[model samples]
Target chain A: MEALFFEKLKEILEITDRELSANDKFKEYSEWDSLANLSVIAMIDEEFGVVIDNSEFKNIQTLGELMAEIKKRTK
Target chain B: MLLSTHHNISIKGLAVAVPSGRISVDSFYPSFGEDIVQKFSEMAGVKQITRSIDQQTASDLGYIAAKKLIIEKNIDTNEIGVLVFVSQKPDYRSPATAFVLQHRLGLGKEVICLDINLACSGFVYGLQTTLSLLKNSSKKKALLITADTSNKTLSPEDRTMIMLFGDSGSAVLLEKEDQGNAVFQFGLRSNGYKFKSIITPAGAFRNRDLPNKVEEWADGIKRSDYNTHMKGMDVFGFSITDVPNLIIDFLEATKTETSHYDVVALHQANIYILKQISRKVKIPFEKIPVSIDRYGNNSSNSIPLLLADHFEGKSQVLKILISGFGAGLSWACGSIAMDTKDILPIIITDDIYTQGDFKSSEHD
Candidate 1:
């Protein structure tokens, strides 16, 4: 699930050259933007069938947190 | 129950007009760099957009479309007893823009002239109000005009919006034909608590004073209090979750299914957003005609513009579902049954109401 999340994140964010780590502050990425944020939310929803609440999504900072939310929902 | 019903209101004709100035999304590559912009364009689903010149206003676009529709359909102008102009961008702050359009369109004082300050959800809401009024009154018809010059409100530095938003005006003619039991059903929703999700920080009475300095934010975009800002994350959640839920509720309440419609004229907000709505609601892609790839997001005008793009000049009957959601943090959907012969092909016009510039001073 983690690998799939990172892979999709990379693709959605259009981050080709660099690898995203779980600890990486995903929102701080140079490519990370409003479009990226929307894409990520959409990506999560599609991948995990989990609709992330707007406020909850905002509080999430790290890539690991996003993955964990998916984990919680999927489990 | 959020559902509202009106009977015997048939859409007589629909027309949309765009100003001659065209702005292509590809042109932004030079300023923002090729790679990122390409990604943005692909995600947002904007290729080129029709823009009204600075001298022109939203009502100008509305006027041309309304006139064309009136002339083409041979609609009796005198019978156009109600004119509702829906847009956030009005010509003047004082008089309702509908009154201006009413005068320009040769509508009389006895007519209903009003303005609705709505953006994306304008179409269904406009239809609900106009149809109800027409049904109650002795007047046989009401002209529902939704137009917006979104380009004017955008901040150049705010890349998220600059290219994605477009300008155009649309005119939908609703005739209260007391026959055939034509029924229109609508369900609308709003979240004022999340109103800040999409807002212009200044330039209104609430935020009247524009900051003298443009501050560079963490995103590196410089904007003052006057520019519009959209919280993409919040809007995405709203669009995918709230918007489709509203549609689903409307369908369940109305006892209709997504597959039942020949066309689902959803707002051309983004290609991704459109797809998400499709996935969430189970509406097929083929049934949803998109104009955003060519026209960008024309605010309230998107649904009608989508109709004019596909069903224009074609003669056929269609069971249609129209949904528009955004800005006001509002969303609405309506089921419409109409004949395609009533939908007019879009026309391009550069006409501006020059006197509106308000430049000349009286020699008193």
Candidate 2:
């Protein structure tokens, strides 16, 4: 599940990195913008059936954070 | 700027090029969302809109129009001294569509070819520009071509703009002749503040981004920004608020009244907008020539294309008050006259190309 989460994150970010450090801030990356937010929301909704509201974007700032939220909601 | 001296420019000939694929309101209406199509039908009175196929671009349509005009009128290609192409969709950003058209038509190298990037108000503005060019320069004959392929810039989800536009081109040959069509007196106005009211929010200076940004927008599911976007209410307000005043101003300047015009050819933005403006300006409904019902707004080609369609094979002394408004927050109104008795037979159709496929004639 961790590997799958990173895979999705790499695909979404178009980054070469296979793993994200826990403290990594996704927004600090140059790829993050309104378009990236929408893409991430779509990815989350399609992959995990987890609906991400616009306001909740601040909570899921990193790949680990997003995966944690998804696991919490799915469980 | 006002003209110190008025020069009579003759529309010696006219030709129109429509896409081969045609769709009636029935077939085409379903493609657009039902509500939007219904609203357009109600407003523009367009029962059908002729559209182009993938192989045919806006310049192609212009070329076709010019070809037909030259053929039917038996005018030599070498005689055309100036070529003005009025289009929002040029063949390329660098070389003007007029250059392509001039090459295709075998027009001489001496001919001055240029393109104008105006949309809905294109015909009137083109006329105004052509008149100035003719009067200033020693050019004797000019070809004014107005064409638009709104489908290239529009997405299927953009119901408001999609229903209002059709792909087509028209050509009018203007020559200096005494006792020709009535001297064209124009009232033109543009307000850049409302530029965003109608635009494709990509590919130009304000929206230009790196190649990566374009790729991002392209890959995204939502492609609204690439299509023509108009705050419908704002554009409607602009049209209704400004058009009547502009018409009145033109009438005042020319010292003429509505009764003097045998027909009024206002931009076929939509039926409701036309009717409202007609009511506001106190022009009788019958006096207004509306091709919007059959051909959705053909952008720059709307007025002359409508004139070509309506006046084909008709003989009468017709005084026309034509007005066009859109896109640049631009508005232009003018008056001209023609004896339509000797005009050639012209065909108008509602064939539109969709998703790179030519929909066979639904109207015929």
Candidate 3:
């Protein structure tokens, strides 16, 4: 499940899992703009059947945090 | 609810006219930065848009399209018993634009003329109304003109609207025919509760007190009371949630299956929204004809524009499912079965019509 989640995130963020460490920050990515933000949310919903509000997106900053949020929503 | 016309009325002709001025998304690279422009282009699924010049208006384009249809199809002006103009952007605030068109088109004085103030859903609703009028009355013909010059109402800095809308107008000629092959069934709906999801706050009487000045909003977007504002996330949610269900209900109401129609034309809101609707409705993406990549969202004119663009110079029996949803928070979906001969090739013209410019060829 972790590998699959990272694969989807890597595809969305346009990075390889080798480059996407848990500590890697969204701010570090050049693609972290409004469009990517929405794309990530849509990807999560489409892949996980979990709804993430725009407000909730700001609370997570790193790859680890985003994964945690999705894990909680899946739970 | 599902509704079907009681009498047979055939669509004899259809024509769309867009202004000759074309603006490519890449043209905005200097203004919006290439990165943002590219991102927006990917997200909105718009490549280029046609815009009317200051000298042209929605009525101008619609007039041109109607004239072309009437001339090319050899429709008699005196036989057009009704002229309905469906637009959110009319030529004037007082006199209905349809009345102006009646005079400009040289229709007889007895022709009924009126304007319906609607935007995205205007075409389907206009088609339903025209079908009902022709079905109940002795009128043999009606001209339904759906147009939008909504590009004029936009703020270039408003990222939500600026990249999404284009200007266009279309004319559809409907004639009463005995045992005509046209069969129309419709599903219409509106939710005024979510009206604020898309609105122009200042031009109307209720919001007239507010100043229409563009101000920098959050996330580098700018807007004003005069400009159209849309809550992008809310609209996306509403469309994804409502549109698919509407299509499902419409199919059930019309007694048809998803695979029944030859083509489905949803309002050219954007490629993203249309594709989402198609996916949710379980229709193949190829079945949904998309013209937004070229014309942008021309509001009510989009469905006919899609037909004109897709079926131009083609001849075949077509069962088409068309849905239009937007402003008024309104939506209408319907099925129309017609022949390709009924759809005229799209005509792009820069000609701005004036009084006496359109004379019946019969007079010549």
> Between candidates 2 and 3, which one is better according to TM-score?
3
User: How would you encode candidate 2's per-residue C-alpha lDDT over B1-364 as one tens digit per residue?
Assistant: 2322246776777777777555566665556556545545665577777777666678878777787788887887776788899998876677787887887888987787888889899998888888778766666788899998887877654555555677788888887775543577788889897788788887766666624122223323234455666655556656666788889888888889999999999888877678767877889999888888777888988887788778877778777899999999888888766667535555443333233232576446
Candidate with the larger DockQ of 1 and 2: 1
Collision count for each candidate, in order: 0, 13, 0
- TM-scores vs. true structure, each candidate: 0.95, 0.74, 0.88
lDDT by residue (tens digit), candidate 3, B216-289 = 86756787788877766666666666777888987877678889988998899878778778877889999998
Per-residue lDDT of model 2, residues A6-69, tens digit only: 6787787777854576567887887675335545665665577565554466666666777788
Model 3, first chain, TM-score of 0.82
DockQ in order? 0.76, 0.01, 0.30
The candidate scoring highest on lDDT is 1
lDDT of each: 0.86, 0.74, 0.82
Residue B52 shift from truth in candidate 2, angstroms: 0.7
Candidate 1 local lDDT, B13-75, one digit each (tens): 898898888889889888788876888888888888888888789999999999998888888
Write the candidate numbers in order of decreasing TM-score.
Answer: 1, 3, 2
Please give the distance, in angstroms, between residue A52's alpha carbon in candidate 2 and its true position after superposition: 38
